[model samples]
Target: MNYQWYPGHMTKARRMMQENIKLIDLIIEVVDARIPLSSRNPDIDELGKNKARMILLNKSDLADERENEKWQEYFTQKGFHVVKMNAKSGAGVKNVLPVIMEACKEKIERDKQRGIKNRPIRAMVVGIPNVGKSTFINAFAGKACAKTGNKPGVTKGKQWIRINKNVELLDTPGILWPKFEDQSVGAKLAMIGSMNDQILNLEELSLELLGYLHKCYEGILAQRYELEESEDRLAMLSAVAKNRNCLKKGNELDYAKASNILLEEFRNGKIGRITLEQA
Candidate 1:
């Protein structure tokens, strides 16, 4: 799966992010827990340089626990405050508040020293689409928060949601473009449902996913779809089709319908909390 991203959109997103960076104290970057490295935008390093940074390994509920720990350590070693979370369910979200304050401790102390007291730490949530930014905000703020509407010169209608006395978050998440030049990166994103479904070959993607599950997870396919363990990837796909009764008008196996079933099941966690990538 290859993505054709226009440079014009990239330029605009970059420009908008640069402008927003100046008005915030911390950058809350959300990345898919399954492919933490691949899901991240490389340009974030440049854009967030000299700013306090925190990495939320969102959707941690669906990722492998061991891989999640490794990814947390990986990003922390690189000077990013890392937290593993299930943004949809708000699991591991409460831990984020303390981490957020810790990430911006220096800035908070600076403000205190200059006699600027009672000011909440300003934060902006940013990530590529479908990484669950809106869900996170909604979960974090609940129903008690107020939207501070329209700051001058900061995009005419941008609203800020006061998370608490100590933290205020920008209501809108900054959109970042993924690095789609790497074919593996694109494939991983597509497997995780971040890419557009119309352009993908479902059968091909399902086969690739099956190959990964057989190699990394082992016996997952056998347990889920009641298939014989085999080294051949296509054989496993065929077995899945056969078990699920995916067939055509002439009683031929319908590989495409089976492929859709496989991918959808994986996405909805019917395949059982499988993560596509590891450390």
Candidate 2:
């Protein structure tokens, strides 16, 4: 399935980000741990150019541990203050403040030299849709200042949240580009629940996911559904439908139901700690 989702509100969101980018001192970008690169909006890099960058690898618990480490190193090498965090459970959330200080160290030093004391770091939190920007904000602030949802497009507008005396956060809506240059990036984003599921073909998407799991994580489906593993993705999905009793009124295997189950399980990490993209 060809994946593309750019809601009309995103244009306004992009404009808002551009207008506010100049006022921010640091760019605190949240990205999905399972698909770090794909979950990022390329526009953020341009918008945050020459700004202090801190990357929170949100939902780290759902991603492959080894791959998460590799991605951390990758972003670190690229000069991002990286932290692995599961925002839902607040795991590794305590590390954010210190790293924020670290990322904006020069600014703090300059402020101190100018006799400016306790100048709070102004950070713009950005990410692609459903990458946990609001959840991270809530976790970092230790309060629910923004709305949180399992689906994408939760934050409709920007909200300034005072995190602490040391930090003030500008929380913006998650933004995707006008078009994906590489469709694979779109597909990966869709699989991670960044795209609207209502507009997607789940069965086709599931086949693609099944193909990957069978190739990289063989025997996982068999273990989860108690069915024989197969190189054929369609056969495996069918088996999953039958084994899980996903059926229509006439006892026909319901591939749609099976597809939703598989995607939901994978998205929730019930299948395993799998990374759609490797660093």
Candidate 3:
């Protein structure tokens, strides 16, 4: 399915990022571990040029462990300091600060040489919507310094949070590109709850997800739904609906309900530690 979502606030958010990017010494980019490349907004490379960069693979607990390692290596090869983390439970969060210092060692030494002592390293957290920027900030800061929400666009403005004497964080709203030129990227974002569900066709999306799972993660559906996988994706969804007892008053299968259940389970990691994209 083809997809595109660009809200008005995102335009403003982009402008805000451009205005505020120059104030920070580092850019902390968070990407969903399941779909790291798809979740990344390439504009950040241009927006954050010449700044220290760190890639936090958030929600790593839900992604395939092997894929996480590959993604870490992929980004490291491109010179980004990478950390795999689950911001919700604060797992792997402790490594972030030290990695940030290491990534910006040159800048820190320059400050010392110029005698600019005690300047806190300024970093701005940025990512596409629902990739867990606010959660990361709260976890990293050891407090709820920013508002956290499961829905996209929870962070509407900019707020600087001081994590410690030596580091400060500027939290910005998640910004998606104005257009998704590749439809696969949009689909992956939608699967990860980065897009508004009201505007999507859940049943069709579920079918797409089922097809992907059947191909890449073969026994997931069989294990989760207790039904044999089928070549026809719709047939597999029907089996899931029957197994889950999603039915209407007339005893017709409620495909929509079944679809929602499947999507939610996958997003919550009930299906397993599955990664949608590979390095």
Candidate 4:
């Protein structure tokens, strides 16, 4: 699918991030563990060029365990301090504090050298829409400091959350890049609910998701829907509709209803701990 979603607020958020990046010592970038590379905004590297970087693989509870390990290694090799976490449940959230200090060790040491002591480390949480940035902030801060939502564009402005005496967090609104040149990246993001659902064709999106799952994770559909898989994704979807009783007024299969069920179950990990992309 040809996918492009750049709302006006996201443009304003990007500009705000560019302006605020200079004030923070570290960039705590949150990415979906299921599609780490696709969920990242490429412009962040340019905007946060000189700052210390930390990659949080948020919502890791829904991703493949082995893939999470691989992604952690991948980012760590690229000079980023990585942490895999489920922000909603606060799993692995404790590890983030020490990792933040470690990531900004140089800056901390510089402050000590310049006789600027007892200053908290400044950090900013950033990510693409629906990547769990707000949830991570609330979990890491051990309070409901930032607003949390499942949909994209919940955070409209920036808020500085002081976590403790030693740390402070700047929470910014989720931002998407101006455009997606790679269709695969856009598809992956859409599959993971990073895009606005109102603008998408759910049936088409579910079909694409089924195609990927059938290829990479065999037997998942059969196990979940209790139907024999087929080479044709639409046929499999039809079977899913029949088994799930997704019928219309005339007792005909409701493909759209079935599609919504499939996408919702997959997103909530009821289908399985599946990862759409690999490191």
Task: Give the alpha carbon lDDT tens digit for every residue of 1-279 in model 3.
Answer: 668888899899989999998899999999999999999998999999999999999999999999999999999999999999999999999999999999889999999999999999999999999999999999999999999999999999999999999999999999888888889889989998999899999899999999999999999899999998978999999999999999999999999999999999999999999999999
lDDT for model 4: 0.92
- lDDT string, candidate 2, 1-279, tens digits: 778999999999999999999999999999999999998889899999999999999999999999999999999999999999999999999999999999999999999999999989999999989989999889989888999999899899999999989999999998999999999898889898999999999999999999988888888888898878777889999998998799999998999999999999999999999999999
Q: Once model 2 is optimally superposed onto the true structure by TM-score, how far is the C-alpha of residue 53 displaced, in angstroms?
A: 0.4
TM-score of every candidate: 0.89, 0.98, 0.99, 0.98
Question: Distance (Å) between predicted and true CA of 17, model 2?
Answer: 0.6
* Overall lDDT per candidate, in order of appearance: 0.78, 0.93, 0.94, 0.92
Better of 2 and 3 by lDDT: 3
For every model in order, what is the number of clashing pairs?
0, 0, 0, 0
For candidate 1, lDDT tens digit of each residue in 207-259?
88888898888988899999986779899989999999999999889999999
Candidate 3 minimal-lDDT segment of 10 residues: 1-10
Per-residue lDDT for 1-279 in model 4, tens only? 688899999988988998988899999999999998999899999998888999999989999999999999999999999999999999999999999999988999999999999999999899999999999888888889889899998999999999999999999999988889898898889888999988888899899998998999999999999988777999999988998999999999999999999999999999999899988
Q: Indicate whether candidate 1 or candidate 3 has the larger lDDT.
A: 3
Error of 3 at 87 (Å): 0.4
lDDT, model 3, position 8: 91
Question: Which residue pairs show collisions in model 2?
Answer: none
Error at 105, model 2, angstroms: 0.7
